[model samples]
Structure formats: structure tokens, C-alpha cells
Target: MNLMTLYDDVINEDCSMIVPETLNTPHLVLRYFRPEDAERVAELAGDIHIASGVLNIPHPYTIDDARDWIGQHRFLRDHGEEIIYAITVRESAILAGAISLRVNTEHAHAEMGYWIGRPYQGYGYATEAAGSMLELGFRGLSLHRIYARHLSWNTTSSGVLTRIGMVHEGVMRGHASKWGVFHDVHWYSIMDDEYYSSSVHADHPGRDPSGV
Candidate 1:
């Protein structure tokens, strides 16, 4: 059976528990963050290069900031507002980055966001983790669409999205402000049908609870 048929078969079933606490891929383990991870999160995210590319991360990210952010994951996930995962190396369990889907359950859609630590940038961790999230969003959460946006100048991020089969929606001129400067942003999305039909979706690493 194809993914769309599988999606239809399981659409009305209770999928709240479908997503595992940890999603495993070839080289990474996407899991929930713990309090002890705060220091490492601060260390990695504090880099000026990491902060400048994203809108929300502050340049001098602190342990307290990381704690505050990690502390909210449970409440947000339990309430169906967001699902965030700490991207870790499979063998070492070293935290490499973070990824999330800010879900709008009422609309059956979500926005994807992520960042990899400076040390992990070139290894395709972002793409692997993102592909898992797409599976979680579309297959597990039953979302109609999943979209992501990045600063227009961040071509690397755009490449990741494209590599995962997200179509370029368009650019929003001066759509976001970071560090007091306005910047354009590029938007990309994949609908459920598009996701199920794509070859990339077939190869993405994740356990399909629905047996698609």
C-alpha cells in the first residue's frame, strides 16, 4: 500500500501516542531534552555564527536560556502545540542540534524549525533529523502540510529543505527582523499528498506505526 492509502486508513485513529519518545536514524537519535543538556545546549548555541543565522537564538546564549527552553518541551508537547527533539549522535548520544514542529492542530498544519551546532554543520545531521520530523508530522500527527522558512541568505538551509523534497513557495521581502535589521525570508512546504508521492519520503528513516 502507498503512504496516502495508509494515511487515509489511520487518519481517524488516535495517533497521539504514535510518535516514539526517540526517533532513530542511521547516524542520529532524535530525542527529548533533559535538564542536564542545558549546559551543552548553551555551549553549542552560544556561538555567534549559530546565532546570526537564525532569528530567535541570541548571540550569547546562556545556560539559563537553554534551561528555560528545554523546560517548556514537555508542556508544549503534551498540549499538542509543539514537538521538539534534541538531535544526538547515535553511538555517542552527543547532542548535535535541535529540531521542532510548531503545530497548529486546528489547521492541521505546522512550521518546522531547526539548527545544528557549529561542529555538526557539514555532516547532514540536519537533513536526517528533518526527514524524521516530516515523517512524524505527516504520518504520525496527521498534518495536512508542513512548512519551513529561513533567512533568504541562508542558502545551506534552503538546500537541506530542497534535498528533502520541499518545494520553494516564494520569498517574503523584509519579512523578518534580526538584530535590528530587516531581512527577506524564503518559504518552503510539502503537503500530505506531495509527501506521500515523493521518492524522498520513501527513503526517509523512521518507523511507520501505520505500516505504510
Candidate 2:
């Protein structure tokens, strides 16, 4: 479907906002979080290594935290503020991580963010999921720009952003403080025109060009 079709699907008779139910990638499925997934989410996200690499995750993440986070998804989506997907393996339906886009509807832009569990790292899952999100943001949501930020020391995340066709947008020195230490932040982004022109879209055969 084109943007208009996707846009209409995201709204119902009452005019409340909603996200596409699912987005598929070659080895993964992006879907909304379920209450049952909370335990696993806490298990994977509680790793100190996982929390240290990103700005927001608490090192001691718990199931309650996961539930709390998941609980906000619907309210946020209904307000046109965010979309968060549980990234799961297609074959086994196992939760690998989470990805999100915080949107600014009036500006037609969004910020992308994601993380893969330690056990699932280095398998290209994050990259695949991120590319699909870019498609949903630009093609499905008709967003003008999608940007992401990462800790400067996290070269792995920077590489994923680059592989997905995002341009390096510079860094904010001492911009983030996590666990009491200040860290610099690297920004990256891809515009609508840039995304359509990039090889990233053509490389993902599983992604439906018609939008999620």
C-alpha cells in the first residue's frame, strides 16, 4: 500500500491513532509487545552491558519495568507519539529485542532507537530490524526525516546506522550521562528523498515496498 492507504489503516472510525500491526523482515517479525513478553524483555534488557551501551535502559531492569514500558505503548500510539515493536525471530518467535520510533507528527519527523540482546548480538538482527523501521517511517508513515542517536563509544551501533544508509550528522559532546559518567552522542539520519534513493531499500527483499 502507498502512504495514504497505510495512513488510513493507522486510524479508525473514532480517529484514534494506531500503528501497523506488524512488519516483517527476512529473519524477524516486528510486532507490538504483549504482556507475556515482559519477563523475557526484562531478562535480556537487565544486562549491565546492554544498559551501559544505551542511554535509557536501567542496569537492573525488572519485569515490572518491562510491563510498565509495554503498558505505555498503546497510550503513546493512540496519541501519535510513538511506536515500539518487539523484535522477534521469525522461525522460533523468540523475542530478541525492541525497536522504537518517537514521532513528532507536526514536524513529520521521528527518532529511531533499538537494542538487541547480548546473546542475539552480531547476527545482523538489529540491522535488519532497523532497515524495516526506516521503511515504515518514510514510506508508511510519510515522515520527512528519521534520525537516531548513539553513545560515541558504541561503534557497533554507528556501523548499523551506516549500513542502513543513514548519514553521520555529527556528535554532541558530553551530551549523555549514564551511570554517573558523561558520554558523547553520535547523531545519524536519513531523509525521505535520501531513503528512496538508497540501496538499503532494494537490499531488503522481505520488506514490502507498499509499506508494513
Candidate 3:
């Protein structure tokens, strides 16, 4: 598990705006979405398995759906309410998946979530992207806490959360209704102090300077 920390210099004043045009990881690039990505986004996110694992994405994801979804990103970021990124492999620039952070202005915290395309599973891309998001939450955004919840059956999602140094808080029994039935959700979180004290965050070698 190679956990890369967000460089302190990347964050702008007060983190009212955390994302720049793009973020670089050792093997990935997290960047703002473009209209041209609609086709690939639709192809990757259209998997029934992928849609079933997340709360929001609908199955049979269409090109129009992808376009509409990417269209909302700019407005969300401009309002300081959310930060979403398109994940791509650094080597090939393949659209691997998507990740996001939903900010709670009143509480100074955010909910982080991500999904790796079916073809990209088992490559650690989701974990890598999520680690960057966590850095944005704790360091860039000056958030007190960052949390995420996954349906109980989604162990891969749980593993990604664990790999990022988030602690399992507990399970909310049947806390969410999805696909017309209730499901248990596992909650995990990391606080600012915990993020600073963690060896994972401390040993980060800083951002990649090669530029994405």
C-alpha cells in the first residue's frame, strides 16, 4: 500500500478551493472532468456491478447520464460544496474511474467515495486516488474529520478505506435503502490529528513534479 500525502504547497488560501486543475500521484492523475470524457465514463461506469456497489450511480448508465453527471462537477466545486475528479492511469492516461469529496460546510468535514472501473479492479488505483482525497480533506480543506460508509458486502471498498488509514467506526444496521431494500453500512473515519500523527501521511515524499 503506497500511501502518498498531499503536499502542503498545493492547497490555496483557507482551502476554500482545494482542487487545482489536476493532482499527480506516482501512477495516476486526478483531474477535473471534461465533456470529452462522456463516452469513456459511460462505458466504465455502466457496469451493473459497479452501479450496485454505490448508493448514487444508477445501473444502465448511459452516455447522456455520464454527460449530465460530469456537467455538475464545475458548479459543485465553484460552490465549495464538493470536489470530484476523473481518475486516469499515468502511463496510458486510461480513464480508470472517479472519486469525490462531499464537503459539509457547517461541520467542517466531508464524505469521501470512489469507484474503480471493472477493468481496473485489483490494481490499487482506487486506494491511491482515495488517499489523495483524504489529504485534501484533512490538509487542504482544514477539515476536522473525513468519513465514508460502504455497504457491508462491498469488502473491496472497505479495504480501500482501510488502506488509506481510516478507522472502522462501526456499522449502522440497515442504515441505507438501495435497490429497493435496506442494507447495513460500515462507517469509517480519520480526524485531522490522527492524519498528522499517522506514519502513512508523515512519510509521503511530496507531490510528483512531472506534472500530469
Candidate 4:
């Protein structure tokens, strides 16, 4: 059997836990959000550099806004709609970013999304965390496909998507409005078989170190 079928067997046997407790890469840990994380979330996500690139964040992202956002994660997870993680360093345990997968169970796919704090942007944390998230979606949740999108001008995000083995699909012109400006969105995706066949996945040294 190929890697994809092998993963299906492994997940069916020992991976009985529904939602993973934590997901780990060589350098990062993707854990469930905590109430105490609001301060750091606000501090990192509130930056103009981060907020401006994504369509959802608003200017002056307040602590209340972070709390409210974090608050919804559990509800969403409990309902099997999404899984949101706080991305942190494995050694330092410092918050580096956030990553999430919005599941569409009926369609057997999930939409991946992520952002790194300005301080952590250059360290490859986004790519590392996102790769682990993809593993979680495919192997852990048995998702058939995982996809992500970025603003056309956000080449950094595009690079992260590519680094994680997603295939660039196409662009949606004027697909979203961010900070009162409309922007084209470039989409990317990877199917389970495609991921298993990828060089990145074939030699993925990180391998969700926590095995979640």
C-alpha cells in the first residue's frame, strides 16, 4: 500500500482520539487556544502588518477582540466545524502565530488558514505550523483535501503555502476587501494522495513530533 493508504490504516487503528490534544513540528507546537493567550494574541495580531494582509482582522485589534475571537474557538471545535491552534515555539514556548482549519465534513475537505506575528515572520514558523496542521487534517481527521488562500500581493503567504506542499490553483480577482481595499486572492490546495506523493511529505522530518 502507498503512504496515503498506510496513513488510513494507522489512523483507524491507534488514533482513536477525535480532536488532537496538540500538534507538534520540529520547531513549533500547535496547541488549543487558552483564555490567557489574549494579551499575546492582541499584541501580535494587532500589528498593521499582520492585520492589513488578512481580510478578517480590523485595525487596532483590541484585547477584547482577541478574547472574543479566542472564545469562539472551543465552540467551533466542539461542533466539529473548525480547529484553531495557537502556534508557539517548541523550545521557548513563545507564541509565534496562529493556524486553523475550517472543516467542511459533508464535502470531505477543509480550508487552512494561518498568520505569523511580525516578529516571527522570517523564521519559517508559518510553514512549519501549517504543515503540521495539514497532517492533522488529513491523517488525524481523515480529510480528503486541504486548501488555503492569500492576498495576491502577500507573496510571503504564497511561499508558505507552497512550502507546505499546496498546489496553486488560481486567483479570485477582487475576492475580498481588506482595510477598505479590495484585493485579489490566490488559492492553493493539496489532496491526501497528492500530499503523500510529495517530496515534502515523503521526507517530512518534522512528522508531527507529538504524534497527534
Candidate 5:
């Protein structure tokens, strides 16, 4: 079977709880968010530090809002073409953040985005989670290019992209607006060739390491 078919088999579980969690390295994990996650999600959603970088998440996010958000994720999880994964720590059931992938069939590529809670910042959760998502994009999804971007002023997100080894593709001036405030975004991408070459080198030491 193709990788997409296997990936489908993996997430098609009826209970969702039955889906085996993907262990991304050791510090962070990527998994489907459960409805029970609403309360915990509210804590992050309410923080301006966490929500500001995002275009839609408003400060003082309501519990009722979180309930609706969870319901939305559940619907997307079951029927949508895109995949969204929540980043959570293993020891604690608390959610640190979330990352998502949107495929562009026309371009034969996908784009990724993410956010982390304020308290969880600087611990490298975004970096770790992004690496896992990159692996999924290049390997599981078998896509040609995976891109990610963030507002130019959002240093935390820029750092996360750099940490994950994505090559910056420059900025989009006045790309979007939030709360009537215009924001520019920096774009970054990794191609299938880039990912494959890096993986081959990392897997084989004492080699040229440059895909020479």
C-alpha cells in the first residue's frame, strides 16, 4: 500500500484513543486531540502571548469557545483532508501546543503552522513538534514541498522554524491583517529532495554529509 493509505489506516480508528500516538523524538509527541482536551486548550487560548501571533485566536478565549473549537477539530479529524495534531508532553497530559498541515493538490505540496502556550515557550516544544510534522510531511504524506510561515515580528515562531532546519524563503509584505493591524510574514520551506538528502546524511556518518 502507498504511504498515504497506511497513514489513513493509522488515523481511521473509531475511538481515536485506539490510534497509536506518534512519538516525535523523546521530549514531545504528536497526537489527535480529544474532546476532553477543551479545558486544557482554554488555558493556552486565553493567553494573549500564545494567541497574539495567531490570526484568529482572541485574547480571553472562552470555555464555550473552546468547546466549539474542540467540536470543530473533531469534525476535521474525521472528515477533512487536512491533518491537525496536538503537541503534548508525555509525563503530563497537558497540551503544550498544536500544529497543522494543509495539502495543496494543485501544487503537490503542503503547508504547516503551529503555536505554543506562553508557559511552554523557550523549552523547544515547537521545534520538536515541528520536526515531527516535517517528518510526516516529507515521509508519511510523501509530498514534494512543505512550507511554514509566521508574522515577521513573531520572533518565537521564526526561531521555531529555524530550529527545525527549514530554509527561509523570504517575507510576504503586508500579507495579512489581524485586529486591523497589518502584519508581514516570513515564509520557509523544505523540499522532498532536501529532506531525503538530509535524512540520508544523518543516517550515514563518516560520509560527505553534503549529498555529494
Candidate 6:
């Protein structure tokens, strides 16, 4: 069993917005994972394309595995160690993916990670959920930095990180091993200042990025 801690409330300017809720997008919604979601999560996470791209997702995903994963997440978030959300669709209610922020309360930073199912590849759901998490990290958690990393060979992951405004911070050569081989990793991040300034500018009626 993966043991986890419960919440220790962190102060944020928009503390009220820190509550758990679903975030909607054109084709999907980011929400909490339920026990019933284990089977579907296993299905989506079982594929080599999805599992191999990630650090810990096993290729032959099982119901027990999924259950344990979600259980660990619930425990961790409840203890305030991290926050995670399931990426699902409103119409189908299928588990399409996941997004999470592993917090470093002392450093006021969190690392973001995600993976989309093989069938949903090429769509923009990854970036969409990523944007939502970034919003939560900066606006709700009041975090100072959010960083992400990917295997150097994974162009798709690199694209998602770059598209979200994180710069290539460099590589960690042979720093990690997966699938019987060592791999290099690319790091990227966004600072709190950038998020805050962008938010203020977007809220100004005349200068709104959405241009309502």
C-alpha cells in the first residue's frame, strides 16, 4: 500500500479557488478520479505508447494497479503533498488522461506531469489540461515555479511543454533509466511572476487576451 499524508492548508491569495472542481474544455473536462475509474484508467494506461513515455506507468496495467495509484493520489492530496486530476470527457465519461502537481511546499514549487491515451494522440487535450493545471498552480496554489521534464527523444512531450511557455532548461544526460535503457531528459519551467503579470493583463477589459 502506498501511504500518503492529509492536507496542511497553504495560504494563497485566491484560497477560495483552491477547492476541488471540474474544469471544462471543448472536448474534455479535468476532474477527480473515482474508484470506478480504475478499469478505464488501466485501459488507457496499458498501451506501450502511453506507458513507456512515462516514468512509472506499467505497460500491463491492472485494476489493482490503477486502484493503488488513485488511492495514493487521494491520500497525498488530502495530506497536502500534491494535487491530481483525471482528464475525462463530459459526453463519454471515459478516462482520457491525467494531470498533477507534485508540490514542494518549502520551495513554493510544483512539478507537472501528464499522459494522454494512445487513441487520443494528436489532439490538443494534453495542452488544454496542462493549461488548466498551470492556472491552478499559479492562481490557486500561489506557486513560484512549475517545472516539467520529458525524455529527450520524446518530441511530443517537448512540444507540449514548449507550447505552454516553458523554456528548455537543458538536458540531464543518462540521468534516468527506462525500458532496459538509459535516457536523457529535458527540463522546462514557468515562473510565478510571468503567470501573475499575464493574469493581471488578461483581466483588464481593454487588454484581455480572450478579447471578450
Name the candidate that leads on TM-score.
2
Candidate 2, position 58, lDDT: 91
Weakest ten-residue segment in model 4 by summed lDDT: 1-10
Q: Estimate candidate 6's alpha-carbon lDDT, on a 0 to 1 scale.
A: 0.74
* Candidates by lDDT, descending order: 2, 1, 3, 4, 6, 5
| Model 6 agreement with the true structure over 15-127: per-residue lDDT tens digits | 21233567766666899888888898888888878888899888788999999998887667755577889987555666778988988766878899999887666667787
lDDT of each: 0.83, 0.84, 0.82, 0.80, 0.69, 0.74
Tell me the deviation in Å of residue 39 in model 4.
Answer: 0.7
What residue runs in model 6 are displaced by over 4 Å at the alpha carbon?
A: 1-18, 198-212
Q: What's the TM-score of each model vs. the native?
A: 0.87, 0.90, 0.87, 0.87, 0.81, 0.83
Tens-place lDDT digits, model 2, residues 1-212: 22352555663444345667889888889999999999999999998888998778897999999999999998888877889999998877889899999988767789999999987887788889999999898877888899999998899999889989999999999999998989999999999999988876644433322211
| Deviating ranges (above 4 Å) for candidate 3 | 1-18, 202-212
Q: Which candidate is the best by lDDT?
A: 2
Candidate 1 weakest ten by summed lDDT: 1-10
Better of 1 and 6 by TM-score: 1
Count of steric clashes across candidates, in order: 0, 0, 0, 0, 0, 5
Q: What is the lDDT of candidate 2?
A: 0.84
- The alpha-carbon lDDT assigned to residue 132 of candidate 1 equals 87
Ranking under TM-score, best-scoring first?
2, 1, 3, 4, 6, 5
Report per-prediction Cα RMSD to one decimal: 6.6, 5.1, 6.1, 5.8, 7.4, 7.3
- Per-residue lDDT of 107-204 in model 4, one digit per residue for the tens? 76889988888867677678788888888887777789999999999999998888889989999999998866789999999998987788785323
- Please identify which of the two predictions, 2 or 6, would achieve the higher lDDT against the true structure: 2
Candidate 5 local lDDT, 157-203, one digit each (tens): 77777666678999889998877888898899888888777742221
TM-score of candidate 3 on Cα atoms, chains taken together: 0.87
